[model samples]
Target chain A: MKKLPEWHRIRIIDNPVIRQALVIAGIIYLFWSMSSLDIDWVRVGKGFPRAANILAHMFPPDFSRWQLLLRGTIESVQMALAASFFGMILAIPVGICGATNLAPKPIYLAARAVIILSRTFHEIIIAIFFVKIFGFGPVAGVLTLTVASTSFISKMLAEDIENMPSGQLEAVRATGAGFFQFLNYCISPQALPRYLGVSIYRLDANIRHSTVVGIVGAGGIGQVLAASFSRYDYDFSMAILLTIMSLVFLGEFFSNWVRSQLR
Target chain B: MSIILKITDLTKTYPTGTKALEGVSFTVDKPQVVAIIGPSGAGKSTLIRCINRLVEASSGEVLLGNTDILSLNSRQLRRARRQMGMIFQEYNLVERLTVMENLLSGRLGYVGFWTSYRRKFSKKDFADAFELLERVGLSGYQNTRADALSGGERQRVGISRALMQQPDLLLVDEPTASLDPKTSRQIMRLIVELAHERGMPALVNIHDVGLAQAFCDRIIGLTAGKIVFDGSTRQITEQVLTDIYGEEDWSSTIRKIEEENEVGAE
Candidate 1:
């Protein structure tokens, strides 16, 4: 019988010396970053009791201002829906322009720039900016949600269009169809299901963000919740929190049902 | 017979320095069904695509009934494309659309954009789609989505969609590359029969030499971006196969054709 040569498993990095040096450098960096943070252990120890007191005051949630809570929640829901409608209207053209297969290079770049610009700032910051411009109202909240939703939906939609198989679109083009006609027959049908799914998910996300945007005086349930906290009205704040929780649960259930139906 | 399609000095060189086709040329008379057979990467698919400008030729002239297709601008090229019907290897149907809508999509060039967008095709287009669907043996499948059908059923729909254009010529690229043996023959027969029925010429790219010999009237064998053999099925000797596909034991391949000939003779 012939003797076999010894073998060894291959290393991820072929050079063992460089690999060891990289691992050591990474470990040292992790430890240095961890030790650099300033800690106030004594203050952390005092926070437990304060948190417990807040929880105790939050119990036995009051419903005395149920009508006011209801009105604030309705306003938030209205902002979410209106923003979703307008954002989707804006997103369709922007997504079409952003798709590498569908649009010219210059237009694709411009559309991508717009989406990036919208996504750079957080919704709360944008709401503050809009509040300063439009005064304290639901209008600012609506504008903030619209901008946020447009970027999210348009980016997802452009990726979906880009991932579609080119053969189907090529077949449509071979039929000598006009550009718009080809879009209507070929691109729309292929894109409809994914676009529907993404749009519903974004609407759910927008609803959640609408509540947060109102903390900056943009007019929603969150504003009421924030005011109650400042005034030490913990029970009323608890009622507003419960209402927000129920609304999120409803949005989640509705979005899931719609997505399943799309399938 | 009048010439329905002509190609003169067609060449295609990719940007990466791969020459896919070099100085390829051919012509088809009315009602003729020509089969292009070769090994993989032999420029068979590229030849068919160049005729329709799907893959732009490096330098060539495609004279489709006196108009040089490559010379036409975008608008004129679109008008020129209307006269040419192309079938693909993958049966590239929009999977989410219904069979009737896929069929009606062929008439998009003639109808207004808004008209087709509303799905309000003219009555004449609808009647034609129905008739083509029946002729392709898919009579009651108008409402079925393209993805729901079997492979053979999808190819049937693919053929019907191409015919719906009412084209003057047909360019088929590997129409049977994905089907089982029996389905491949059925599709090949269907394509040739339709071309004859319409009195139009068809250029088909195929990998199966046996099927090509069985269905097509003329065979063009290619190797390494050049045409090595162009003749009838009867003229395909073993030496010719070796020359086109490189040296090999071609006895089994040739014997199959003789057996088919015996069956036909009987």
Candidate 2:
């Protein structure tokens, strides 16, 4: 080579101008938002004595509400299971349709539309909407979580399918496998472990979502906790929080076990 | 020997306008083992795939047995595909599936959808699968996951899977490209012998002219998306190899011959 080009000598980190500008902008934006906020540290500080008083009253979580807590937790788990099962079943076809290599352009766009629509709203917002329609209960919780789970699972599953080796699909096609048959054999086997991995993840997410949906009067222990918080029954609220944490922990362990077995 | 597969003026032009096959036509009759030989981009794969309508011929008629396969509707094509089996250089067995499951997938066209889905294949399907496993010398490896297999073993499963279809015609695409020369010869012999035993015609797309000539009854040489030579293997000469490979060493051909003689002597 006669000489190294000037452009070749330019290192990526040579220009910190844009990076410095972004950091300055972010700092200014954060200060501006902080000024506009409703946070009052003095009020929060004053509430701590009340918090300590309630903390003292919370003496070992009341066993009187234990049966109610158990039933609520069981309902939440059932909702999670139902939503996960239906959502994952629906997601399989949607994921297949969204895969660019497998589905036609129109079908892929339609499947993507479903996923986008499902994902556009937060689970709590969807829960509120479903509660309005379904008149509040586990039904709304199930429906909301179903939409959330479908959106999450289908998008990731579609990506996994898109990444599968085309040769394996061709081999199945050469065997004369029809669309569903080919999906069942060639694509399913390839995508399954990943799907299971994602499904378990989604199940864990759905379980967590079930608890939040109850705050919107959808169902589960969250309704009781929200009520206790509103009524200033901080001890009962503490009990609910502890139960929710344990439930989440248990769900996580169960899903991890399922994922390990799948692997 | 009756006409098994008849292709007339087959052509494939990609959307990007790279013409892969230009009006290529050939016919396979009876149980003859034929190999299509050419350089890398000679459309050997395109030609083989076109027969099964896998690549979808831009313009052609492919008659498999008595039926013209190109005109078949989706449903009819699915039925028509049952009679044809394809083996790939990469083996293409679903890696997560068991070898037995891969073999049973060959009969998916015949099994009911639910039956196949539940993997509760018919007793006849199971029996035939076990028999094929034994025939392919993979009797004890049926329960083994396909991904666990070596290259040669995977191709053996690929072969058994194809045979499980009980196809009347077999399409092989560069079956030995990924194999060692010795393993290549063994795989070729397995395919040839299996074709003979099943009395089904086999069409192989191969790069090695020496291997093609050693096993195949007929050799069709393609160059740049067109057929440059089509003749019996006995009629092929070093000149034809020159026409196909385009000024590569013929010395490798001599070495291949000596290797074959040594194998024969052993």
Separate clash counts for every candidate: 0, 0
The docking category that best describes candidate 2 is: medium
Candidate 2 segments exceeding 4 Å error: A1-60, B118-124, B254-266
> Considering only chain A, what is the TM-score of each predicted structure?
0.87, 0.86
lDDT of 1 at A143: 96
What candidate 1 gets wrong by more than 4 Å, as runs, is A1-38, B262-266
lDDT of 2 by residue, B1-266 (tens): 67888888888998999899988888787688999989888899998888888888899889988999899998899888888999999999999999998998898888778988999988888899888888778889988999999999999999988888889999999999999989998999999999998888899999887888789889898888888898887677668788887886687785676677579789
lDDT of 2 at A160: 96
For candidate 1, give the lDDT of residue A172: 91
The candidates' DockQ values read 0.76, 0.75
